[model samples]
Target: MRKRFLVLILLSLPLGSFSQDINFELDFSAVYWAPKSNDTIRISVGNNGRYIFTDSEEVAKSFGSITRRFQPAGGKENADLKLLFDLKTIFMLMEVKIGQNTVLANVDLNQFMKKGKSIDSATVRKMSATPTALKIENNGKKYKLYGVAPDNKPDDLIYMAFNEKYPVDYDTYFSKLMTSATGELFSIDIPSGLLVHVEDSKGEIILELLSIKKKKQKGSANIQLKLE
Candidate 1:
């Protein structure tokens, strides 16, 4: 029987200042496969990432009536607070509903390569070791970083892509929180910017991004995020 996989992706736009609050929409899909099982999970994000609604009746029941959102308990600093709050909350609930056996192990680069997966060994190692410190490279954008400020890239891709999309402190607070002695908040080493892909090195999960985009209702037309 072919083993099934799961993928988890976190994305957020830098906080942008518009004349008026705008309404944006998010579309997410998750595909699950087993020897005798094949199902597609679809989720719609509304209310500025505060509400997550599903089209599947069975899946909806699984999530329960409780809503998942970022209602920081106060004074508690988390690196992925704003960017991954909704998705993280949903995943935590899943671990409880689906049982621990279904939960994937911590991602390990060496173990993944041994399994015959093709990816940048050195780069993945760097990212896995120091996600905050390492940079993601793709589409002519080399060594892209997420931090208090942007790197020396003439195009300002990282900043322009996220700066106005999410809160400014999202990166600043996260960077500081991650470096604290208390330790990292997220289990995975995620670099900054709008993440479009993820590889669960443990082989338990293999999530792919179907589509991720942002639409402006009314605001200054600016550069949008592009991940290829």
Candidate 2:
């Protein structure tokens, strides 16, 4: 009787316990094919919106270990506000810095998709196969999500699996990723409570979950993304 009672109590707990509000770290990678050669770039992201990308695994490892601080330049209130991801406001233009150059990421899907080699309808269909339910065993301290099995449709699988796990109303999520501003779009609504990983359905892109830590309060400093 006691064992059954305990089982019933466990089943009654709110799902929130399984998903607490916390920051996360993620790793991403993708292979790009050129006429003569192909290269893979690696990216790492922290839930606080800091990220670094490099072509070498060693560089990615070093960057992933460093602690980054972001602050405003001038003494301005809400100076560090991320408007596009602030949820309360409508979507706005945003720019991201890569090395010494900065570029605009406010473009729509059609423009973003142009970056990758085009795939046919048959390939798209193969990738869009129904995603399997993810079995997430969340302990009070850590969480884990299993990877999708390798198959013909990497892109469609990624899209379907990612959306199924973390449903965002905005289709712009993919567009944001095209600019390599991964881990930025989830600042809004995410049904999974927290997003640890995401990948492109076609296998061209990948994001890996690394860590989830408490978000520390920020001090007053004027910081903002300088948009062009």
Candidate 3:
């Protein structure tokens, strides 16, 4: 009788209760829609929520010559720029290391954002004013990052979008991740925590959530796509 009771209790417990706190991973890559060149860039985001930037501007410039003119000043060569933020606000710039280099990220802000004491609608507006950046738009099926024209009107400068077939519970996390990813790449802000749909040929640089991998402890995963 007791043995039967023990088995019943185990069966009644919630599913996945054991593996909730273990190793997890998500891998995202950006690839050109064109099959001719078919160049792909891989970005690795760690469990601690750190998004590392490898190459953004140069890749954008390569897509089209027009992007060269919108380069953010300072010749900021972010070969391996590991920029960390609060995940809530852009002002909370945390210092993290990339190799042996000490990242003076605040200095980079001068070229991209208008520094202020508090984060408000006004500050966000100023930050979004940079021409090189693209704002992310989240529709139900996909995400779009569009740009504004020089005269403050909508322009077809950069039209990029990618899919968001991720889990619903992780929606918040993905939104913030896309925000930092875009910011580090093109100095933009994604107010809505939703993302991805890469399209068109307007010389815009953005990332798409290529793949997501999850696992438990004592397990690891690395997804790689070699360029030809």
- Candidate lDDT (C-alpha), each: 0.28, 0.28, 0.32
Task: List, in order, the clash count of every candidate structure.
Answer: 14, 9, 6
Runs off by more than 4 Å, candidate 3: 1-82, 91-112, 115-151, 167-196, 200-209, 214-228
Instruction: Encode model 3's per-residue lDDT on 112-215: one tens digit a residue.
Output: 24322223232221123122345454433434454422223334344544343322222234434333433322223333321244444455444444443342
Q: TM-score each candidate.
A: 0.26, 0.26, 0.31
lDDT of 2 by residue, 131-201 (tens): 34443222233333334322432432342223123223332242244222321212222232234444454
Write down the lDDT that model 1 would get: 0.28
Give the winner by TM-score: 2 or 3: 3
Q: Measured by TM-score, how close is model 2 to the native structure?
A: 0.26
Evaluated with TM-score, which candidate comes out highest?
A: 3
For every candidate, C-alpha RMSD to the true structure in Å: 18.9, 19.1, 18.3
